[model samples]
Target: MQIRDLPYADPGRPDVRSGPRFLYWLGRNQLGGQLRSLFWGVVHSGSVALFPLAVGMGVAAVVDRSGARLAAAGGLLLLLGALTALGDTMLHRTAVTNWITAAARVQQLLARKTAELGSALTRRVAAGEVVAVSTGDVEKIGWFVEALSRFVAAAFTTLVVCVALLVYQPALGAVVAAGVPLMALAVLPLLPPATKRADEQREKAGRATELASDTVAGLRVLRGIGGEELFLSRYRSASQEVRRAAVRSARMWALIAAVQVVLPGLLMIAVVWYGALLARDGRIGVGELVTVYGVVTFLLFPLRQFEEIAMAYSFSRPSAQRAAKVLALRRTAVPADDVEAVAGDLKGDLYDPATGLLARSGELTAVVVGDPDAAGRLADRLGGHAAEGAGDSPSVLLGGVALDEVPLDVARTAVLVQDKDPVLLSGTLTELLDVPSSGAVTADAALTAARCDDVLASLAQASPDGSGDPLRTRITERGRSLSGGQRQRLTLARSLVTDPEVLVLDEPTSAVDSHTEARVADGVRALRAGRTTVVFSSSPLLLDRADRVVFLREGTVAAVGAHEDLVRSNPVYRAVVTRQTDEEPDKELVESGKSEPIGESA
Candidate 1:
């Protein structure tokens, strides 16, 4: 594939069994690009190697005092120069194209894998590692892929030149051939340490990146708790560690580079000295000595390619391994044979047998879990996402069909779960609200329902001109420029616009005021009047608006009823919803089944 045909429609199924295999797989898929690069590289290296021969011939012609031979030598030099220029130019173009194409393909694969795994990707892989892989690791992998062809061409040209030297003037050629291989192998001993140092540097840098990401994500919270300095200190220490590791890595690579330079210089000196002795003895002509010296100098360029290949492989191997690990992740562990598509319409009750929680069709159900962690897990299960290390297949069902059996797209389409923390990507308000929706709800209506007029006004006021359209206003990354409440409202609005068959929201309004929360609750209930919606929350305002509330304790259904009825009957439910402790005397009496309804008594 050419550069213009980049971003393949299908990046193809990768062989993620191991890092080496993954790298091989990527190369195999781009055979055409590699061949193109290889062809250009051969032309370039061959042309360059022949330059010394042309120069040597010209010198010989001058020494002979033959005009015809001199003219012939000059013409050959001009032709070689043109060929060299053409070959070098094309080789560069092809190499860069290979790099870009490989990087783009890997990026596409990553994006597809990320989309396939959804939130599970983060659960299985650290966010920092993911960031590192997608950013730096990608470039390193591409570098190795692009360097491979050039290295092969250089090695081939070097071998041919050495053999030609052996045949041309065996006396001087023997010394030159013997020394060239020695120069190439001189840096081998340093490669191990260099690779180790590089890996350590990458590890430290990844940690630093993750730390920085976490700190930035929770900057507001850290400031509120007066812990910004603590995090800042920790981050500073991490950054310093990364810096030190980088210095160590750089030092090792510097040593390798030094070896490459010094050894080539030594070989050149040896060749020139030996050639001078041969010339003095009349064993070889002055022009041949010049050729041998010039060839040795040119050989320096190809010799460095050996060190470059070593460095490229050292860096890219681990990067490919990391990428392979991420790509190997599966959203759920259901066997392929068991994956039966949903046979009917994608409308049904969303039920999780693990928790005995069922969200009925065409109804608003609110789940109240005492443990927030359990609530989050349940939400994931309701959306057919098995928890990490969960051995059993996801047992959530839709219309009696196991969710794990249905295709991922089908499952996602049937149930949409919005966790407590929804992220708003950086974009204009209009782009942020634009999503694949059922077309039942308009953006304006969703925004109005989420009570985002104030958010729009603030965005507009924050604009530099202070008079542009609100929808056109650009949001900062993660909506950091907006208040927590505003971000939450905007996210909720985005979710509402989707209008999925089954919408699961976890604490959708925890960041908002009571007044705004109540309005959001009412708006949600009205908008989802005939659609199945499951909300996991404990707020009285939200629970009161629910048609039915399912109370979960220790991951099992403890009570199920209307919010008012549960509040009056179940002491534990009342304690959870009211944010009170069951140890209270009145609550204890109700728990003991010896008192009136807590609501009536209060």
Candidate 2:
């Protein structure tokens, strides 16, 4: 693939079995580019290897005082120079292409995986770890793949140079050949220690990154609770640990580098010492001895490629493993094999078999549960979240077809589940509301439906959009700049704008005041008059407005009726919705001039 073609049209499924396997997959994906790099690498190194041969011939011609031999030697030197320049230039270009394409391929895989898993991706892996992998880890993996071809070329050139020397002058050639392998093998024992150090460094760095990400995400909360210093201190400690691990890793690598330097120098000395003896014994000419010395010195350059390749592999292995781990995560299964296609145009009831909760089409249903975790799980099941390790997953059906069986894109288009703690992405207000256009809801209408007029007024204190509208105001990441209630309202507005056939909101107004919560309940009901809406909440304000309220006990639906009837007849429902107990009977309701009618407004 061409470098310009980047981000493959079909990045294709990756082989994420292991670190090495993933790297092999990357190489396989861009086979043509890799081969080009390999060819250029061989040509360049081979040209470099011919340098000493030209030098040897030139010295012999000078010694023999032969004009023709000298001219031929000069011509050979010029040819070697041209080849080296051309090959080296092209090799650098191809190697860079390999690096970019490999990195692009990995980035595409990560993006695809993120889209496939959605929010569940972070639940399975740390958000910071995901960030680290997509950024620095990808570059390291690319570096290893790019360096592999150069390493192969270097090995080939070394072998060819050694054999050429042996054929030209046997005595010195034997000594030079033996020294090269010894120098290359000297550092094998150090590799294990270096690899361990690198792994430690990566682990510490990932921890530091995680700590930093969490701290930043919750900075506003930390400030509110006066715990900012505690988090800062923890981050400082994590940073120091990363520093220590990095230094340890660097020290091991430095030792390896020193070995590379020292051993190559010693090998050069051996070749010169042995070559002098061969020249003295009259077994080889002085010019040939000079050529052998020059050849051995030049060998040191290619030998360094081995050191570089080892270092690259050491750094990249852990990164590849982390990338593979993320790629292996699968979302809830889509049971396509056991089911046939269902008519997408037919709107039907949403049924959760595990909880026996059925929300009919065109109804506003509120689920009230004493346990928030159970409520959350029901909401997740309704949204088709795949729970782990189940041979037959509990399915949520829409239009008689399991939601899990429906294509992910179609399922998502039909049902949108807003989490209890919804995130408001950072952008101008207009950009934040700019979801894909569907149905008939506009941003203004959605904002009104979610009761965000006050939010707009608050934002209008700053400069408004060109139309003098606060809808264009900038929102910080996760809407951290806004109050909890305002962020909740804004998130609700965004969800409304999508206007999906079914909107499943999990405690969407938990942070808002009772009055604002009542308003949101009214707005949602008015806007979603004929669409199925499921709100998981036990708040009296929301429950009172829902057409039907399902009371959940333990894990299953225990009662289903109008909010007033259930509160008056069911003790468990009254205790949950009114926050009543034997000792206290919801003082907020009692003091608000509302007496013991269970569903009375507080």
Candidate 3:
């Protein structure tokens, strides 16, 4: 099947849809697997379920006719048994292929979604939830999809056996045929509750996964505050909640299992009771009674399968809906399609109507504010992370194009934003700089700009299992293997490689030493000459090299001048940048009971 044909989130679809419709969609896509298994299912089920009944009929014929009939019936049973074995083998092979295809299609959708959303994806979805969906959820979904066809094939085989029984004795045939439906329908009432319970369990499980992920991600930080026990206690509570939810779900499923067994047995008993009465009245012969009983036994297989189909679907529906929600998140903004069709030097005039701030093109703009939250949100909008109220909210612009109007892919490739706390993905020194883009620049150039020329020398191409070198090496997840400064520098270096038209760096040199920070500032100015660059730092070294600095008073632009000009002309801006707020009296702080820090921390 083609990748595009697989179901993604179709948010527009109505909710009144049914399980049969879902089955049909899956079945339509399962042609290859079905075709491979169909003949086998037909042969194997027909032989295994139908042959015994057919033999019972033949045995009745032989008993009436003696030794002659017995010889012919024996030969026929052997032939049917061999056919059943062949069909059994083929059916298994085909069903597995079907399961695999369905799984592959879901994986493709997930991969495409991850690419479409980029950095914004993790912001919207938990890493552990995504991981669980890829491994466990996909398998569950594939199973439900594949089960549809086999379920139908089993039901159809049962129908054929019932018809054969009817031809032999109409009274028993009608009873057996009618009873199968009643047996299957008994479980229908239990399905909705089962699915509801399953959905609850799934949610609890996802929450538990998120809790563990959060704790592990902040493990070092948690230890620093001695809050590890607090978090561990919270996690323990969450795990207990999940376990309780799981038990409730298991109970419902158990009831379903109990119904599956009891209902079919009741149907078998009814057939036996009625068939005996007919034989006693001389309306049906003994051999016909045997065939009737055999046919009812054969019908049990499909009846059981019908119950399984109900159970499979009840669990899969909610997962599919959850997956759809993730796929349905609209992009933060819809940028104009006409982004110059090419890359060029972007004059760094940034305007955000939402915050009433503007940084003119071709200058280093330092946005100083008392509110860091406002700054970060504004940064996300500029970095192409989809904003929540972006539709009605005002936007930041670059090169006279509203940031929201720029397509995500183009905006991401063109404007790079390095957050203050950037993460370095694990890999060789080369790969770390190549994140969000391929390794397009020479390793030496990126390292020079990020000031990681020395850090690279300390690492080697190594593997856990040994023996591997290809100019590529895998790094540990989240750069846990590297030091904090090392990770930050590597991230800055990689962001530099793209050499975007606009570089909005939010404290890029925060983790490095003063000397390394100075070098990074010099390297940044040199590497970004003629390009629009904005570095969000209060460091004097970064400020000294700026072509211009726009001082922000609150959210609005209060004054615009060179770094020295702003320092001399604007009192509040100077006091804020130079950490002069501490000079204020302790009586003023105690009287107000609240105070604002001049240089805000993100």
Candidate 4:
């Protein structure tokens, strides 16, 4: 395919069995581009190799004192120069295109895998490692893929030149041919050490990258806890380790480079010295000796390609492996043959047998768990995601069908889970709210329900152009420019716009003020009326609005009743919702409507 037709309709399933296999798969997919690059490379190398011959012929013609022959030699030289320029230009163009397209294909595959895995990807793989693979590793892989064709062309031209020299001038050609191979093979002993050093450097760099990502993601928390200095020192040490490893790797590659240069220089000196002796002894003509010298010198260029290819392969091997590892990740291990499709119109209660938590159909259920970790796990299980390291597949069922057994697309469409810390991707306000929906709610309605009018107003006021339209305002990456409450509301609105059959939100209003949280609770209740909505929270404002509240102690359900009933009857439930110690007497916090605000304790 042409470069313009890139971003393949499908990058096709990659062979992720191994790193080498993945690299091979990438090459096979781009065979057409490789062939085109190879053709141009051959043209360029062939034209360059013929230059020395043209010069030798010109010298011979000048010596013969024949004007006609000199004129013919000059014309040949001019033609060769033009062909060299044309071939070299096309060769470079095609090679760069091959590199870009290969990198693009790899990036596309990674993106697809990420979308398939969703949040589970970060759990299986480090966020920093993913970032490194997508950025630096992709470029390294592309370098190796594009280098292969050029190396082949260079090797082919070198072989043909050696054979031609051997036939035309046996005495000098023998020395040239024999020394050429020695020059190419001289650096073989150093490749292993160089590759090893490179791998070490890559490993260190990945760790450093991961550390930096973690530091930045939790920078605010670190600042609040006065732990920023501790993390910074830790990251500094990691950065130094990476620097040292890089130096070690560079030294090894430099040694290999020195060998490549020294061997080629020695071969050129031998050819020039021996050819001069032959010419002096009447064994070869001056014209022939010049040709031998020029040919040996020109051969050095192609010989260097060997060293380049070796270096490229050493660096790219590890990169391809990392990419393969990420691509091999699976969200769930359900076999393709075992998948069963769910009816499009199916709707029922969402149940998780692992914890005996159930949300009846067409009801608002609030789940209160004493342990935050257990609450998070329940949220995941509610959406059919098994807890990490769990032995069996998630037993969460909807409409009498196991979620793991049903197709992933169907499972996701049936249940939407918004975690405690939902991320807001950077984009215009309009683009952020545009997502797959059931045609039941409009963007404006969702925004209003989530109480995001203030968020929009602030964004518009901050706009450089002073545009009052909030939809035209832009958000920074991860919504770092916005406050926690603003980001949470925007995320909530995006989730609301989807209008999924079952919506599970974990502490959706944890970042907002009491007034905003109360309004959000009401907005959610009104918007999600008659729909299966499961909220995992202990906020009195939110719990009071729930039609039914299920309380959990040590994972299993301990009590189920209305918010007021549980507060007065269940002491454990009261302690969790009121944020009070069990030994502390409950003063009926929910009843008095004097619940502590989020991030505060009694």
The clash numbers for all candidates, in the given order, read 0, 0, 7, 0
Tell me the deviation in Å of residue 589 in model 2. 18
Runs with alpha carbons beyond 4 Å of true place in candidate 2: 332-347, 351-358, 369-381, 385-406, 420-499, 507-523, 526-530, 551-560, 569-602
Candidate 4 wrongly placed segments (more than 4 Å): 332-340, 343-346, 353-356, 370-381, 384-395, 400-408, 421-434, 440-494, 511-530, 545-547, 552-571, 582-602
114-167 per-residue lDDT for model 1 (tens digits):
887677677778899999999999999999999988998899899999999999
Ranked candidates (TM-score, high to low): 4, 1, 2, 3
Q: Tell me the tens digit of each residue's lDDT in model 2 across 281-326.
A: 8888878987888888888888899999999998888899999999
lDDT per residue for candidate 3 within 483-585, as digits (tens), equals 7787788788778777776778887777788898889888877777766777777777788778766556556666666677767655666766776674443
Q: By summed lDDT, which 10 consecutive residues of candidate 3 come out lowest?
A: 10-19
Q: How close is every model to the real structure, measured as TM-score?
A: 0.84, 0.82, 0.81, 0.84
**Candidate 2, clashing residue pairs?**
none
Between the candidate structures 1 and 2, which one is better when assessed by lDDT? 1
Candidate 2, residue 81: lDDT: 89
Question: Which structure is stronger by lDDT: 3 or 4?
Answer: 4
